[model samples]
Target: MPKKRVQVVLNEDIRKLGNNGDLVEVAPGYARNYLIPQHKAVFATPGVLKQVERRRQAEQRRLEAQRQEAIAFKDSLETIHRFRIERQVGEGEAIFGTVTNQDVAEAIQEQTGREVDRRGISLPDEINKIGFYKAHVKLHSDITAEIEIQVAPS
Candidate 1:
């Protein structure tokens, strides 16, 4: 006689098997003795599959909404186009300190009333002198906004 297999939905990740919420087939003995008793997985029933499908759909909807918001924000940033940062001049248009991502984020918020995460902004090079530079701001996985930054002495 052949050994019977059981279908189960994992409550947590199992090595070499599947991740949480994944449906997998395993030996009946393993499912009944170890997985069920240890609360690591449950039998994959019709109700369980339906619940998982619903949760997946909800998550997709939420992600789509966030992407839409990022698109709108990107449009707003494009309209603004440029932001200015004022710093103390030392000599020959060179500022006392280098411009940081936090400074650029603050400048954007001050000028446009929009909040941007500092970690997402990437500067081309060090900004030590008063001049025009470009920055790339990653708003979403697929969306990036380029804003011109003007550094002027205060």
Candidate 2:
């Protein structure tokens, strides 16, 4: 049997739970296909795991500390004021204009000093007329924000 140094993906939070020099049991197929290709994990030897335990502990602590920092920032982000976009209403009880994704992104950047890409802003539907609307900002996979825009007569 040929022993191979293989990288494996753990079910745990690999960022905090493992170190480069630590050996973890992973599926041979997974090690050969995924982890090695993505560079997300590394191969380690059995003897090295014991030595890298300390490094793993440090990484967990650091990951926790950084998580706390991110939480703090996220809380502050909730306080970010929403930018109100006012537009003119026209015939058929609709806005006399089309509000585009670029408009939404620019509004956020103008108000929050955050340069949000328009592609990340999701509108429920096309804004073809005058009305109050909600726009979505996908800040992260789990975190999102709704922005309110008011359309009025110009």
Pick the lDDT winner. Answer: 1
What is candidate 2's CA lDDT for residue 53?
74
Local distance difference test scores for all models: 0.92, 0.65
Deviating ranges (above 4 Å) for candidate 2? 1-82
Task: State model 1's lDDT.
Answer: 0.92
Clashes of each: 0, 6
Q: Lowest summed lDDT over 10 consecutive residues: which window, candidate 2?
A: 4-13
Q: Positional deviation of 50 in candidate 1, in angstroms?
A: 0.8
lDDT of 2: 0.65
Cα error of candidate 2 at position 109, Å: 0.7
Per-residue C-alpha lDDT of model 1 across residues 92-122, encoded as one tens digit per residue: 8889989999999999898878889999999
